[model samples]
Target chain A: MKKSNIKSKHIINHPLFLPLVCLLLVLIVNLIQTPSFFKITIQNGVLYGFIIDIINRSSGLIIMAVGMTLVVASSGGTDISVGAVSALAGAVCVAVLGTGESYRMPYIISLLLPLIAGMVCGAFNGFLVSYMRVQPMVATLILFTAGRGIAQLITGSFILYVKPVQFQYLGSFLPNVPIPTPCFVATFVILITWLTLKYTSLNMFIQSVGINPKASHLVGLNSKMITFFTYVFCSVCAAGAGLISVSRTASIDANNVGLNVELDAILAVAIGGNSLSGGKFSLFGSVIGAITIQALTTTLYAMHVSADQLPLYKAIVVIIIVALQSPEPKRWYYMIKSGISSGRSAREAN
Target chain B: MRIFKKTAAVILAIMMFMSLAGCGNNKAPVSNDSSDTGTDEKSKSIYVGFVQVGAESDWRMANTKSMQETFTEAKGYKFEMVDAQQKTDKQITAIRDFIQKDVDYIVLAPNTEAGWDTVLGEAKAAGIPVIIVDRMIQTNDNSLFTAWVGSNFKQEGYDAVTALENVLKSKGIPDTQEINIVTLQGTMGSSAQIGRTDGFAEKMAAHKNWKMLDKQSGDFTQEKGQEVMESFLKSYPDIDVVISENDNMSFGAVKAIKAAGKTCGPKGDITIVSFDAVHAAFEAMIAGDIDVDVECNPLHGPRVEKLIKALEAGESVDKIAYVDEDVFYAKDAASIIGKRAY
Candidate 1:
C-alpha cells in the first residue's frame, strides 16, 4: 500500500502520466488480441499500424473533446451540434471552393474563414439559449438536426469532389514523416487550450460559473457573455476539425460529414473524469479518453464480430463503461458483488 | 361643348362596365365548366382519399408530387391528399376521415408494415376500395386494399445482390474469399429494410463464404447512414463490401470509405451495391466509386393516375400493379445515366 501510494504520488503529479498509462493499457489489450498489433512498418513511406490508425482517427474526437470539456465545465451546457457544425463548415468550403479547380485566396484567410463560420454558428446557438432562454439541449438540438440538412441542401445533397492542391495540403503528412498535419494541429490546439486554462483567470471563471451561474452573476461576473464565448470557442474547434476532415477525404458530402460526432466528444470528456454537472475540466484526460475509445473499437473489429451484432456489442460496451464510470462507483461495485454472491448462494442451496 | 363632354364620359363608362362584365362572365364559364367537365372527362365519378407518408426525402417529395399531379389531372375523381408527416396516428386519422367522406377508393403508403388491420377492417366494412401505393401495409387480409400499385421490394433487393454477384464474377474474385460486408439498413422494421435484408441474405446463402460482418439501420437519413458507416469502418477495418438498402445510405458509406483513404469499387476499393438508382448513385457508378445499383423507381405518380382513372371508370383493374425497373452496372450505366431524377 505504501509503495503504491508513493507511485501514485509520483505519477499523478506528472502531466503525461495518465496518457502514458492509457496507451500502455491499450497496447497490452491489442497485443493479446492481435499479436501483430504493435508491429509498425513503413508501407510506401507511410506509417501503417493498428496503433497509428487509431491515433490518426482519434485526433478529431480529441479536438472536439477539448472544447466540449471546457463548455461542460463552464456550465453553459453541452453542445450536441459540433458534429453538425463540422459538417456545415466542410460543406461550406467545398460548395464555395469546389469547381474542380483552384480558388485564389491568401493562405491565412483560407485557414481563418472556416473558424469564423464555426464561431458564427456557435454564436447563433448561444443567442438562442442564453438570450432567448431556450433549453440548452433543445436550442443546440435545432442545429443538430437541421445543420446537416442545410449543409446538404447547400451542396445540392451531392458529393462535391475537389482535387485542389492547396486544400489537400492541410491533410498532408509532415515532411519525411508519417504523422498527419491534422494530428499535429489537434495536438497543438490541445496544448494551447490546456496551457491557457492553467495560466489564466478564464479557467477559474468557467469553473465558478459552472458551479453556480446565479451566484457568479450576483458576484458581478458576465455569465451570458461567458456562455456565448464558450460556445463560439466550441464551434471554432469544430470548424478546425472539419477543415482537417475535408483534407483527409479530399472530398465533401454534407450528408456524410461529421455525423453523430458530438456524442463521441461528450463521451471522451466524460470518460476523462470531467463532471457532467459542470466543474473542473480535464484537457489531457479527454485526449486519453478519446484514444481509449478508438482503441476499443479497433480491438472489436480485429476480433471479427459480425456486422449485424456490432450495434449490440457497442451498446453493451457503452453500457458497461458508463456503469463502471458512474459517479457512485463504490455502490456499483457493491451491487455487482452482492448479486454475484446471492446467485451463488441460491444455487448452492438448490 | 357640354353635349360632347357628356357623350364622351358616357361612352367611357359603358366601355369600362362592359370590360368588367366580360371578365366576370369569362370566370363564370371556366369555373362552371371546370366542375362539369372535370367529372365527365374520365367516366364514372370516383372519389379517392390518399394518405401520404409525408415528404421526408427527395423521393418522398417526388412521390407526393407525382400522386397529387396525377390526381389533379384525372378528370372524373375528386382526390383528397393527406400528409401524415410520417406519423402513424395522423395516417389513422386520415383513413378514418376518408371513410367518413365515403370515398369510392382510398390510397395509402403506410409508414410501417404493421398496425393497419383495424383501420383497414373499417375501410373494408365501409366498402371503400383501397389502393396501396409505393409502400406496403401489413395485414393477412388481402381484402383490405382493392389493389397495390408498387414495385416488389424483395425483388429489388434480390436484383441488387444479383448485380453485385455478376460484377464479382466478371472480376474473377473467388466466392470463397472472405467478403466482409457492412450494411447500412433503412428504417428498422420498415418493409424496405426487412425485404432488402431478407432478399440479400437469401441470395448470399448460396455462397457460404460471403457473409455480412456488420449491419446497422440509418433510419433512412443520409446523416445517420454516414455516422453508422464511420463507426463500422473504425470497428471493422477490413470491411470488403458495403450493401445499402437505399442509395443515400450507400452514398454515406462511400464517404466513409474515401475518408479512410480507401477505394469504393469491386476492382479497387470496398465493393459496393445499393438500391434506388438516384442520379447520385448513377454518377458514382460512372466515377467507379460504386459497383451496382438496382432501380426502385420513384416515378409512381403516372401509374397511380392511371389506376385512379380506371377505378373511376368503373372498370376492374389488376389488384396489384407491378412496375418494372432495370439494374445498372458500371458497364451499362453510361447509357441510362441521363434518365435518373433523384
Candidate 2:
C-alpha cells in the first residue's frame, strides 16, 4: 500500500500528469457516451474508427504544438501568425503547382519552395522579435494579418485545386497502406526534433536562454540566435501542417486554409503544462495536449452538441482543464486525500 | 390627367426598354455609341460604383466576376469596383466615395446587415440609387436602398430537401423507410447557415419517416467539414444522408468518408446533398463523390442589370429580387461542369 501510494504521488508530480489526465478524461467521456469509442476496425487495409480518427486528425495539430512549445519556451510569447503562415505556405505550393493550364512544376519543387518561403517569413518575424527588440506579439502580428493576404494574391483570390492523386497522398493514406501519411510526417518531425535536442546541448541552451537571456549570454549562449531559430523552426512546422491541409482538400482557400488553428496550437502548449512566459518545457506534454483537444472536439461531435452551443462547451471544458492544471485545485484534491489517509493511519496507530 | 400621363409615360418607357432588350442581349445600352457622340459626349458610359464584400470564397468571387463581366467598357458601363475586404467601414467609405463622385449608380455587397442603415440612409439622402447584392441589409426603412437582390438562403434549404427526396426515390428507398439525416452547416448565424438549417428542418417535418439526427457547423470550410463528419459517422452508424451547407464542406465530407474507408455518393452508403453548385461541386458530382448540389447561383450581375434597366425605365421593381437557382445531380455534372461560368 505504501509503495502504491508513493507511485501514485510520483505520477501526480510528473509534468505530463494533468495533461494526460485531461486527455484520458476526455476519452473516458466518449467511452461512457458511446461504448464503441475505443473500437478500431480494418477496412480496405486502412484503419477505421473513432480513436483512429482522433489520431489522424490530430497529426497537423500535434506537429504544430511541438513547434509552438519551443517558440513559447524561448520567446515567452505565442506565434499567432502560424495559421496565416500555414495558409500562405499552402498558397505558395498550390500557386507554384498552378491551378490552371500553367505547366506543373516538379512536385518536389512545390514542396521545398514553401519551406524556403516559410523560412523567409520566419526570418522576418525573428528579426523583428529578437534583433529589433519589438514585442513578440506585435512582431508576429504583422505576418499574422498579411500572410493570408499574400496567399490570396498568389492564388488570385481563388481556391486553387491540385488534382493529382499523388498530391493527395500526404493528407490522406498511402497506396495500399492503412495508416495516414501525415502520421508518418509528424512522427518524422518529432523524431528529428527529439534527436537533435538529445544529441546536442541545444535543448539546455534554449532553456537557459529562455530562463534568462542576459544571464545565458554571459554564459556564452547566443540568446538572440536561439530565439530566432525557435521562431524559424515554428514557422517551418506550420508550413508542414499547411501541406497536410492543402493535401487533404486537394485545394487551397487562403481565407480558410488555417483559419483559427493558431489558437488551438497555443492552447495545446498551455495545456501541456508549459508557461507562456519563457521557461523549461516538455515537448511530449504538448503532443498529448494537441491530441487531447482533438479528442474533445471529436467527443463533442459524437455527443450531438448543438452547433451553436459547441464553442461554449469547448470553452467550458478548456477552462476546467486549465484550472485543474493550476495549483489551487490540486492542493484541495491532495488535502482531501491526505485528510482521509491520515484518519485511517491514526486509527491503525490507536 | 397628370397621373394618367405619368403612367402612360412609364408604360411607354417599359415598352421601349423591352424592345431594346429583345433586339440584343445587353440591357439598357446607354445612348447608341455612334449617335451618342453627337449629343452627350461627356457621359459615355453609365458610371456604376460597386462596393464589393471581398473575394473571400469562390462563390463571392464568382459573384464579383459576374458583375465585372456584365459592367464593361464595351457594355457601356464605366465600372469602378472597390473591394471592402469584408469590412463594414470600408464598404461605407466606398459608398461615401461613390456619393462624392456623384456616380450614376451605387452597388453594395454589405458585410453586415446591421451598421448599413446610416450609410445607406446617406446614399438615400444623396438620391444615389443603391443596389444591394449577395447579402441583405437591415434597416427600419426599406427605402434606404433601391433594391435588395441575392439568393433566398431558405429556398436553398427547401431545395435540398426536394433534391434529397428525389435522390432517395431514385435509389429505390420507400417513403415508409426510416431515413436518418445529419447536417453539416456553414458558419453559424450567417444567413446561409440559419436559412439552410431552418428551411431544411421545416421541410424535414413533412416526412414522417425522416429523422434529423444532428446538426453541426463546419464553418463552411473543408477541414472542419471533414472533422465534423468523422465524428458524426462514429456517433451514428446508420446516418442515411448528409446535408452539407456548401460545396467546400461537401468536399471535406467526401474526403473524410473515403478516408474512413466508407463510400458516399449516388450509389454509395451515404448520399450527400450540398449547396453552392460551384464548378468544383460539379466536378465532384462527375467524380461520383457528391449526389446532388443545390445551386446558390452567384450570377447576379445580369439580374442586377435587369433591375437597373427597369429602374432606369422608371418602372417600379420588386424590393426583394431572388435570382433563379437550380439543382444539379451527379448524372448531369459531366455536361454541366464545362458550362459553369465560375
**Residue B137 C-alpha lDDT in model 1:** 75
Q: Which is the leading candidate under DockQ?
A: 2
TM-scores of all predicted structures: 0.75, 0.90
With a 3 Å backbone cut-off (N, CA, C), the pairs that clash in candidate 1 are A306-B213, A307-B213, A307-B214, A307-B215, A308-B214, A308-B215, B263-B269, B279-B342
Query: What value does the TM-score of chain B take for model 1?
Result: 0.72
DockQ of 1: 0.07
lDDT of 1 by residue, A131-171 (tens): 56677788789778767766665566566666555576676
Number of the predicted model whose lDDT against the real structure is largest: 2
The residue ranges of model 1 lying beyond 4 angstroms of the native Cα positions read: A1-4, A9-27, A98-114, A127-135, A138-142, A145-177, A214-221, A242-259, A326-350, B1-49, B65-104, B112-127, B138-142, B172-191, B207-271, B302-322
Candidate 2 docking band = acceptable
Give the Cα-based TM-score of candidate 1 against the true structure.
0.75
* Model 1 docking tier (incorrect/acceptable/medium/high): incorrect
Q: Model 2 residue B223 lDDT?
A: 85
